[model samples]
Target: MLEMKLTITAPDLSAAINNLAQTMSARVPGLQNGTSTCAEATNTTSVGADAVPAANPIQVTGVPTSAVPVAPAPTSVPVEQTAPVPTAAPAYTLEMIATAGTALIDAGKMKLLTDLIARYGISSITELDPSQYGAFATELRTLGAQI
Candidate 1:
């Protein structure tokens, strides 16, 4: 990054500043040495009566004082989502299966429930299909028989 060192308090510095102003005025036409070019930038040329006047007339270069319009929220979602329904055993659902498994887990046998789940080569209780829930529950209940 480029750096600039300017000491305004130094008595001899005023002459250097004057020389810079004179050079800018000579090279850049219409940009007067003393007048503020920052204030002159705010023009109501394109904007109408509703345009808000800036609180600060002078702004950082290349930045507009006007409010830019907000982008509207997305109108469409990427994926089409529908509720999962079991074709067979219409009365039972995935929620019921999850509840049953959670009951076993909550009864101080979380390891037993997870081990039974692993035996079926499934990672999560939610992965058990609605039709398979009855058999899965029966096998899980057999853990009590080991006692």
Candidate 2:
């Protein structure tokens, strides 16, 4: 014999029971007239049936209790999915190069900065796109290293 507590939340309680009964009828071996009453059987897992209260006890028979699938309460499922990791921004950006250049210019390399802008054939730093920023920053660093 097996016993388990069931806290069912069906909108139509009788319909749920009927549906359960039909499903159980197919699975269990000794159901009389292809049906069972709430009292005729009890959940098979009841090691200590007397100690347990039966506010809404599910009656199961003719199957191992461990074979039964117990549905956990809705609250047990995690409502909030784990947030996806935020994507990191690209390391090279036009604004970052511009800012880095500004610091270099303040250190007395305004002419060198202007020379770099002319080498790229761009009238101003604004003419360079984000894609060009990495190469330009690399060239600028190489130029600084030479000096």
Candidate 3:
């Protein structure tokens, strides 16, 4: 139910019609010329019906009553595609954990460090599971140690 209007004015009617028709024909492929008698005289252009519905008609102003049937420009609908994002591997390493633990102990947090390792059911860094290195490093950072 949307209405759009475009106006093209020229000194000569035949020149305007011919110009518009030629432009349309060059831009659109597989277009068919309408049954307008003036089309034969001025060599009217053809337009395709693809992406354009025949139900909604175009009205051209400032032209003879036998104005060639006008069709709106073809349009394309874009399809959205989503791609899976790759997750980076954890950067935790045993050396990194050991360094952070040593730093914490040197900074007078020996009791806190021992308590943290016990909470993970480990008596020492060597006894801590490899898979738990990331969590362990995170806890070490919370204790003012850089890892």
lDDT of each: 0.56, 0.65, 0.68
Superior by TM-score: candidate 2 or candidate 3: 3
Which scores greater on TM-score, model 1 or model 2?
A: 2
Off by over 4 Å in 2: 1-90, 145-147
**For candidate 3, lDDT tens digit of each residue in 103-135?**
998999999999999999978899988888888
- For each candidate in turn, the TM-score is 0.32, 0.35, 0.40
- lDDT of candidate 1 over 95-119, digit per residue (tens): 7666766777677888988888888
Candidates sorted by lDDT, best first: 3, 2, 1
List the candidate numbers ranked by TM-score, top first: 3, 2, 1
Cα lDDT for residue 42, candidate 1: 30
Question: What is the Cα-based lDDT of residue 107 in candidate 3?
Answer: 96
Q: Candidate 3: where are CA atoms >4 Å away?
A: 1-86
Question: Per-residue CA lDDT of candidate 2, range 1-147, in tens?
Answer: 565445435445545666776777677666543443344223333334654454456554343455467997677656887998869633676767777788778778888888899998998889987677767888777656221
Residue 106 miss distance in model 2 (angstroms): 0.6
Q: What TM-score, to 2 decimals, does candidate 2 have? A: 0.35
